[model samples]
Target: MARLAPSFGHLVFILSLLQVSVVCQTPDNVNSLLTNLFANYNNKIRPVNDQSLPIVLDVSMFLFSVNAVDEVNEKLVTTGFLGLTWTDDLLQWDPTLQNEIFIIFLPQKDIWKPDLVLKNGFKKLTEMGGDFYFLSISNFGDVYWYPYEVFETRCSIDITYFPYDKQTCNVTFIVWSYSADEVIITKSSGGIDFYEYEENSVWTIVSTDSDIKKDSYESEITFTITLQRKPRYYVMNMILPVVCLGLLSLLVFIVPADAGEKMSYSVTVFLAFAVFLTIISAELPVNSESTSILSFYLVLQLMIGALVLIISSIQLRLHYRKSSRGMSKFFVAIVRIDQFLRCVKRYRLCCKKDVTTVENFDKNEEEQSTELEAAIEWSDVTNAIDFLCFWFLLLVNVGLTMFLFLYITGS
Candidate 1:
């Protein structure tokens, strides 16, 4: 029994030490501190003791992730938390009094905070922060509040150079109830904190800026985030395919007139361009203020396709004409130009030692000259049209493609 008494005393001593440690670490005076702090507190009133001096609130943001950028609707959705700090004279306490409580957290509803709201919200305005959120109050009257939210704000989309474009979006915030004279909002030392930011797949953050604009009526802070599109997806799927199709349309002149496929092939390609244009239009906003250069380029290609179909029909008509009908002067001139471009040379007979050989050569040369001097046939005219049209359309396609892409990239 005597040995057991000392062991029991040792166990009680250890338990007492643990109790003291916990009491020191946990701030047992929190309940009393809160009760005293809010006993005479009025949350409806600003936490300033002086009625003449305004409360200076510092504002900042910590970005978490970029959810989505809706171009058609011109909206930017982001997940982040707003950092707000201000001096709350009503909530201050002396840490040395009543067990040295330095910091206390109170329900955000129980304390006085700036009535901040998103001024440029895409949807209707609503109060920020949930009922469960809390505000941290320090011994010296500094209050810190972090309200996390998924903010959807209005952002004007300029898709003039879409898929290779950069956009600047602003999320504006203001104190709805308080005027600039009552609550002066200032940007924090760190305008925006990107330490917790996650990269987005479609858009890359190029830069960020914050501006605090003050007027006689109110003060507002705008956070601007510039994003550049990662264009590899559009380039591979939309751009490359459209360019290849445009070049393929020029192949109509390559098909022989008698092949019976020229008309159908040209018509099919023209329809394909129409389908692609429709698809692209559906993706973009139907706004007339600004137009995408890619859309213009597509329209030009479609026109070229239409022209190819018409020329194909004419070529087919000329090709089937009866040989009895002589070719027009215009047709003969086109054939001659085509022949000159192809470096076709006239046949000339050379002198031979044998009289019989000379005579035979002269007859052959005279016959060849007569055939050359004869009127051009309908077949020859159609062939010349095909050759000229192929090269002409090919140059046009190449020029348009190169100019469109180069201008887009440079811009």
Candidate 2:
């Protein structure tokens, strides 16, 4: 019994020792599992380095070129954000992330190579960055402009392997936004009464080869605008208003010279021109190297005003001369001078000899010494005014019409 008890006791001690060994072994296994889990997680997070990856990987970027042509002294220009020429899809902005960008200018091989560095240049861009590059002209204004874009990588690598990953990726393309065109002005084929010219526009690209692939992307542009009417200066100043002035002057024959309407008509004609003058001057340059057609018309209007003033003065002198016949010869000579200017040598005022321009009217039917005297001849003054007004007004209108036609037709 004692022997059996001791054996049983040994067995229990042995089982306890085995349990301790298992517990100790369990901690080591747990530690190993934890280390393996962490190591696998990190391996999945990072991609293979240069050894596994290659440098010659595919990338998204833009490619561009400039074109020149004969239709205009203009060029077609384009821009690419990334260094790629093609996009997987035609419709998309530059990829937010990209590998490269490039710009190419296709000038005519025959034409002279421009001194791009002197004015517009790509030097600043090469100085700026390797990836976000620029190759266009720059004014640079004055000081430094290109301290940031370009750089030389210090790390070295094999040339044969391309550094590309197999995961999903994107590529983008860029296009030109703006270009400058030239204008052409040449003589028209259709002959004109006077010399004239016409203007036209077009867009063009320049290249020596007949087939330019880049020009296919370019589109044509045309401009359309509105036209306005210009007013005539000569007729507005000299002719149309003269018809009314003549009508007003004719009233002198209908009413008495002593009545108020004659002086009013003369004054109205003068003031009407003053109003026209104010308006015309506002349109014309205040000072000019050569006088305008408007100025010529105004001078004629001034002469008409002077004639009216002369008639008014003569009439005033005649009225007082009815009481004092002292300067009768002088008044007669003045009447003859007026007659010649009016274009009717037989023109006269009342019993006076020939006179021109509306000299004066006969006594009114109500005021005449006799009703017969009221109907006395006033034909002298009327004839002179008719002849002069007809020719002067005709000249003014014809000149204005021709001027307007020539201006509008570009003659």
Candidate 3:
């Protein structure tokens, strides 16, 4: 009985060692597993026997950040992580041998992968990430792929309501040449996810959504992201200055014509408006479908400024001209209009003492004097004309500015 006990103890010890060795075994190499799964893999053909067994392609995106929205180039640059998954029945492995594995290979690998690509990409697809660019596989023959990419894509921009415009941009994924019978693209479980968001200086992300469209020949997965422009900078730098200049232009009418700087001041303000127009043009897109309301407002102000320049020239000429030889009736009409408006009442008060001391200060001379005061009466006529025009132009400027900017911004 003692000899039998020793032999049994030795046998039990040997079995325990064998179990430990198996438990601590090194996992299988991913390459060896791939070799076993795809011993007869054909990269050129679909990994299915029946064409009716459509290759289901699942796609998802994690938007990490927005790099830039280039208005000049009409492109949207973004950085994000994209994941793809498909199943290949031919690559199944026994879970008892190896549960799951993740491996990465160039697109030119031996195993079959769907030919999915961005439809509106502006650059070629190139690997840009470290360890995260890889493929995952389960024992049930399901294949997963994820890659991080940063690139630009074409986008249509509308600047009609600019600085307050909402833009919708899309990133679409589709099978390059594969048909519906072979490759069927669909959104993954969560579809689209925003992993992180950072506030932008010039634009704000409003919302995001996804949709899938299938046709007889192909399928598509598109992600829509909406963004709005930050208007504070535009209002402060571009809008406010031009509007203030418009108000300053009205002062050209109030400046006394005899000051000798009225024409020069109008010219200076005209040039200032021109400079602001150039600055705004540089910031806005040149080839968009619709022009900005601000551009229209600038042009309107420029036209009014030009008209005021012409009027200032006329008023200055009338102030200094000494020839009243043949226009007696015109001078008489001018005196009547100025008297009716009471535009020169303060000037008369200052000259009252001089009039009382004159040798022949006739009371009727003040009421019926045509030739006696032709030069002075013409000057008053110019002032009366400027006063009326000043109030009219101011109203037009204010009303037009309010209608164009505020109404469009709210809309």
Candidate 4:
């Protein structure tokens, strides 16, 4: 029993020492080890033993979402997470002492990170991380880094097609201070994520592609974003109303010339066409090189409306002319044209009746003369002109509408 007592005491002492050793290596001790790890090393510069050995940085980007794209300012705003990983022998440590496979440190506080800039950006993302900086070191001398960024990039736009246009905008990242030989940049996998994108209200994402471009001294990652504009709103609001206004111009021929409102009605339709032109012009880019087909059609319709207004004015003057001014040479020529077209068949019938009256009513001439005057008055030239113009204007309207429709659809 006495020998067993000393052995038990020795066992208890060894167990107590083991417990103390385990408890002593707490988080504070880990921090102490980290302090020692950075003691002799300068984290401000690249952790390379030889200054001539170039730092090869493997960069990759993954898109999370697109926030907004401002057309007026020509900026593309996006949110994504990207990583920059490189090998640094100086940051490596033995993992056996701490029983940890890797250690994490804030790049801002503990290490030198690559300075990457957006070459075509309107507003650059700040380095002050929204979350923790991704600076991790493995026991095998590998350093992994990453940062979440929101970039507002500048892009040149092609507004020739306006609401129907497809645009290709680029997001490029370049090393700020390093030459190609000093720091090499390479892509990770298939650069960006395409399947996880959310829907956009005004634009649809058509396609996305990424490629690395290198010049003599510069290297960059250029991501091309292809977007198509949604055109339902423009077609419904702008195009349909203009077509309705064009159809309204045809009403001038329906209203009789003697109604006293024919000229005024045609002028009103002409003015309405002009107003729509102004409205559409205000919404689109004025400096665009390609003329909008809608604009061209509106101008053609305006010209047709103006011609109708002028023709109505002429018809009204002919209908209301004083008898003292009696058939001028111009009026005679128009009557001959109506005769050639067989539009004045009533005039021919009246002439035959007058000849019959002159022969048969030689005996009772006074009564025959009165009947002849009434027939002559009913067969006036203005009535023939009204009949001819109505059919002519109706044909013109139908032909133009058909032509314009086919042209627009085919184009």
The TM-score, computed over Cα atoms with residue i paired to residue i, of candidate 4 is 0.69
Candidate 3's residue-wise lDDT over 306-342, tens digit each?
9999989988877777764554566456545545444
Q: Please give, for residues 264-333, the per-residue lDDT of candidate 4 as tens digits.
A: 8888888888887788877664434355555665677777777777777777776666562334445444
Q: TM-score of every model?
A: 0.84, 0.30, 0.77, 0.69
Clashing pairs in 3: none
Candidate 2 wrongly placed segments (more than 4 Å): 1-255, 324-327, 332-411
Question: Per-residue lDDT of 91-170 in model 1, one digit per residue for the tens?
Answer: 88887785767787888888788889999997777777989999888999999999999999988888788768888999
For model 1, the superposed segments whose C-alpha errors exceed 4 Å read 1-28, 189-191, 279-281, 324-326, 344-373
Model 4: residue 314 alpha-carbon error in angstroms = 3.7
The TM-score obtained by model 1 is 0.84
The CA root-mean-square deviation of candidate 4, after full C-alpha superposition on the true structure, stands at 11.7
Q: Rank the candidates by lDDT, best first.
A: 1, 3, 4, 2
lDDT for 15 in candidate 4 is: 91
Give the winner by TM-score: 1 or 4: 1
TM-score of 2: 0.30
Q: What's the true lDDT of residue 293 in model 1?
A: 81
Worst 10 residues of 1 by lDDT: 348-357
Q: Give me the candidate number with maximum TM-score.
A: 1
